[model samples]
Target: MTRLVAVSGSLRRESANTTLLRAAIALAPSDIAVTLYEGVGDLPQFNPDIEHDAPPLVQAWRALLRDCDGIVVACPEYVHGVPGAFKNALDWVVGSTELAGKRVALINASGRAVHCHAALVEIITTMGWIVVDQASPVIPVAGKNYTQADMIGNPALAQPLLAALHAMAGVPAMAD
Candidate 1:
């Protein structure tokens, strides 16, 4: 099975980004097992000294990132940039080999989040992640425009995004 980790950058209970992630999960093919990392808000700031022992929460996130076949990040822009909480969680993995050269997809749910998504892409690329070009299909206003449960029901955006994800998984994995 292709183990995919879907990380929702928003901590809000009713956040658009989180809803977008849920919709993605709902749309995923059954053979691909999806796990959602839902605790970014609890991760402490990254510090090398503290990392020597690695807090339990940080370790858990590191393990998840390490073992996943691929990753999907649904992030919402805050003040025209990536949210601090999500960035902090990502910062903890910088020094580890866990996520180096991993496949990642970035989904920007709202039109206002383009800059933030760009910034996040830059950061993730620098971290040695191979981001799929077709993954960002412009899912403008996932929550405000559509109900949280039906975010991925939009055929226009969902078709391309799902195709991108499956394409990233490729044929051999599917044929098996």
Candidate 2:
């Protein structure tokens, strides 16, 4: 099975990014398992002093990334940059070898979040991750109170997400 971890950069309870990921989970094929990583909000701030001896949460985060075949990130832009909490989560793994050569698919829930998306691409690329262009799509779900079912039901949102999952799985997208 091609396992992919989906992460939402927003920590908000009603985050559209998180909802988009949930839709991805629902739309993923059986062969491609999409697991949502919910520990970003719980992760402690990054500190270089404790790099070698990281806390349990950081360790667990690394382990998950190490085990997964790829990662799907949906992030929101804050003041035209990546969110602090999400950036902190990425910082914790910057020194580790877990993300080297890993495939990452960036899902943009808002079309206006270009800045954060670009920043994320730079950050992940610097960490040795291979960003899959086909998998990275701007779905534009911002400001809309979209439920998981709403996203899953709409082909406009679902088709691209399904294609993204297939791209991450290194497989050709099947005809619907």
| Candidate 1 TM-score versus the reference | 0.89
lDDT of 2 by residue, 1-176 (tens): 99999999999999999999999998887899999999999999999999889999999999999999999999999999999999999999998885699999999999998899999999999999999999999998888999999999999999999999999998989897
Cα lDDT tens digits for candidate 1, 1-176:
77889898889888877777777778788877778998799998888888868999999989998998988888888898888999998889988765788888787778777788889889999988888766655677655756645556667666655765675576322331
Provide the clash count, candidate 2: 0
Clashing pairs in 1: none
lDDT, each prediction = 0.79, 0.94
Taking all chains together, each candidate's TM-score versus the true structure is 0.89, 0.98
Q: Model 2 Cα RMSD, Å?
A: 0.7
Q: Which is the leading candidate under TM-score? A: 2
Q: Whole-model lDDT, candidate 1?
A: 0.79
